[model samples]
Target chain A: MYPKKFENLIECLRKLPGVGLKSAERYAFDMLEYSEEDINDFIQSLEDLKTSIHHCERCGNLSEDNLCEICKDNRRNKNIICVVQHPKDVIAMEKTNEYHGVYHVLNGVISTSKGIMPDDINLMTLLDRINDETQEIIIATNPTVEGETTALYISKLLENREVAVTRLAHGLPMGGHLDYADELTIIKAMEGRIKIK
Target chain B: MYPKKFENLIECLRKLPGVGLKSAERYAFDMLEYSEEDINDFIQSLEDLKTSIHHCERCGNLSEDNLCEICKDNRRNKNIICVVQHPKDVIAMEKTNEYHGVYHVLNGVISTSKGIMPDDINLMTLLDRINDETQEIIIATNPTVEGETTALYISKLLENREVAVTRLAHGLPMGGHLDYADELTIIKAMEGRIKIK
Candidate 1:
């Protein structure tokens, strides 16, 4: 138990995912004991993050300006777009440093149960961006049911177009054990084996 | 891996005690995905806490003004004071509602290894508050080596004074297991058995 103000802080901290009552209390106490300069810095950082950051108009990724750095970078290939479900996925792909193509963040996958549809996404904007100059559109969505459905829908929509469509090669990960690999991964790896595809 | 700004957030979060790299990343993502309204609310709440809260000058407990609510309450006996190591202990005692006296927060206990001594604590102010009218002083320090040393030093200092010194009873707690009890607790329980001291 704590004073009303401390309790309010604890409640706010508990609202964070995975933080329980004990952890909330610890965080509240830590905040309370933080040096004035540290507290100000933390508060200022939060305020800056909230007020300064926004979704990139082109790719839906987090950015300080209307266009993200990736979308604006001239070195990246604008002709090849790697489509992903969320902004976090863009970061994950960027860590590999293998893809020089720009990205198109879907924001979310098409979930029929959740009432999300093709129209709800930025599909039209994506289609409008594609022209004779566009070489390829890569579907880098997760290997989940919704991701597959969304990828299929996107592929079907682009089927009549001249640009090529491709999905990430499904297979066992670099360090994965064959015994522990899921049935789908093994099957997909088998079906999509590169002779070289 | 994330954008430079998100990576900055994670680095700042990692500065907090007990939060490691993984937890910092989790907190960063949580902040990113948090609703705009919720993020604003959290930031505003942090601002409110920093602007509204003040430490009690008298007892070192957190308060809205110069004195904590407990110290301002006239019904509490000023003639008897319970001394503790931290403000959290004051909250714990307040929950019991059994203590009717005021409090004296030492802020910390004596630790020769840490270069802390009696003068390092708020002991001078505590002694100044003690008058001929004051009847008792309760040492509610935790049952640690440092706490015991601090209590002994305070008791020796008060030996010539008219005040009666007391300590919190040490024994098997309400839901405690005797088999799991440490040697010091069992010894203290035996030594502190009720006597006409």
Candidate 2:
């Protein structure tokens, strides 16, 4: 229905998550309407993102250099490290602006059903970093069954380590309604109930 | 929250429709996981779409060359022209596979509220094509009030011409539910009622 170039554009747009045929068509047509300079800027950004940014050697997080911004910031707590499943999770944690600690990105969780093993995750550097300099390690994986499994496995692996190991507190979210909450959430919320003044 | 290049990529991805900050982050990180060659191919496709695809000189539809594929096809009914509002609409019509006639894209409709006038549309070429050789002209705009206005305007403009000017049949679609149909649609269905076997 269109030129080869236009069809090629639609195919590329389709690669984005949740983008269907109609959506890809809309995105392609909209991009074609942009100025040539803006389109060039977009393409340049894509190239830069693919070529420049890479995993930080210190914490296994995304960075321009060997060390990420968090790792380079002396003001942050170097001893406290938050372990997460992905680089995007690191972004989510940063958005809070509350934590002044560094992060260790595992890049993925160990799922036995999916054939993902503990060795497949970025945990070797983490173990090497678990020296006297590291005071605490917080396992902040998602609250799924796989996440809990991975967290438990990591905590057990660090049983002989000198550093303190902890997992994220699980309970009902703020402003959550109990009626709509799942059984696992209810149990966690019940067990972690706080005392009222 | 991320590197300069990563942030730039997220900003560019945010230009897409329905993509929020989280969705943009997800899209960028997902692309980073893709192979470098695949990323380069995607960027090439984007550049080609912006610099190559343009309105056809013959019928105002998208074309790599001067004329669109539909207009260049000798097998199609060139004399029976289907007038549409946009290039995307031409794609939609082609997807039906029922239309074998050539197309004339007006690029836009007469929206009085939006200050879009008849001169803003690509109507001169359409008028030039309406000679003795032309047999029929189908006004196949959307189902909106603006579409109806454009169709009426076109039909009235060709009142003195020798060609038969027509509009798409307004009625209940096949396998449509009468109960769920709007009042205007039901009225159109009643007006355009056909004989049953």
Candidate 3:
């Protein structure tokens, strides 16, 4: 119901996560109204993202160089590594201003249903990064089944390596009401309950 | 917490309607995961949309050439013209397969709050197209206040002209419940009530 090139642009916009056909149409129409300079800037940004961004060699996080900013920061504790499933998680963690240690992005999780195995992700590089001085390996993957399985697999691999491995706690989120949270979350929260008094 | 180019891309993606910062970040990350060929194809589509697609000179509808397909089609009724706010509305009307008339896209509507005047849109071109052969002008702008205002303004403009002016019916949509409809819609439905056999 649109011109050929307009329909093509809409199809490309639909590739973005959560964008549907109707929303894609809206975006395409909105872009059509954009100024020529604005369109050029938008195209330039896409080109720059494709040409400049790559994974950090050490932690597998997104970076414009070989090493990510977190990996290159000398002040950050290198002895402790927080492992995650994707680069976006590293940004989420950093937003909290809580994690001082560096990160190790797995980039993928071991999902048997999807046929993803231990050999598929950045697991080997993680092992290579661990050394005599490395104090802890925090498994901060998501609370999903695949995340738990991957965390268990990694911890099992490091069982005899003399380095401590730990998974992130699972519970209701901060400010999350009990009535709204799912049963699985309630179960985990009850199981991991701590005595404050 | 993202690299410069990655953040830039995220900002650009946020320019799209309904895409917030978090969703923009997701899109940026999602695009990063796309294959090099896929990325190139996406960029090519954007370029094509910018360079190839333009307004149909006759009707102001989006087109790859000077005249839109509908405007050029011999089967459609040139005596009847459906005036709408945007090209998207033309697509919506075409989906019904009921309207065989060509469209006159206003490209905008008269909005006092937004400072949009009838003179700012494609109103002049619409007047230029009207002649003694033109049988009807169906105003199919949206159901909003601005739409009503624009419809009234256009109808008034053509009051002196020879062509007949009409507005699309404002009634409860098919399958719409009267209980859920707003007061204005209910009033309009009542005002436009038809006699049963």
**Could you say which candidate leads in DockQ?**
2
What fraction of native interface contacts is shared by candidate 3?
Answer: 0.82
Q: Poorest 10 consecutive residues of model 2 chain B by lDDT? A: B188-197
| DockQ for each model | 0.34, 0.64, 0.62
- Residue A160 miss distance in model 1 (angstroms): 4.1
Off by over 4 Å in 3: A170-197, B170-197
Every model's Cα RMSD, please? 6.2, 6.4, 6.2
**Could you tell me the TM-score of candidate 3?**
0.85
Point out where model 2 deviates above 4 Å: A170-197, B171-197
Chain A TM-scores for all candidates read 0.81, 0.83, 0.84
What C-alpha lDDT does candidate 3 achieve relative to the native structure?
Answer: 0.80
- The candidate that wins on lDDT is 3
Is model 1 an incorrect, acceptable, medium or high docking prediction? Answer: acceptable
Q: How close is candidate 2 to the true structure, as a TM-score?
A: 0.85
Alpha carbon deviation, residue A196, candidate 1 (Å): 14
Instruction: Please list the residue runs of candidate 1 whose C-alpha ends up more than 4 Å from where it truly belongs after superposition.
Output: A1-5, A110-125, A143-160, A170-197, B1-8, B33-40, B112-123, B171-197
Docking class of 2: medium
Task: Please count the clashing residue pairs in each candidate, in the order shown.
Answer: 0, 0, 0
DockQ of 3: 0.62
Better of 1 and 3 by lDDT: 3
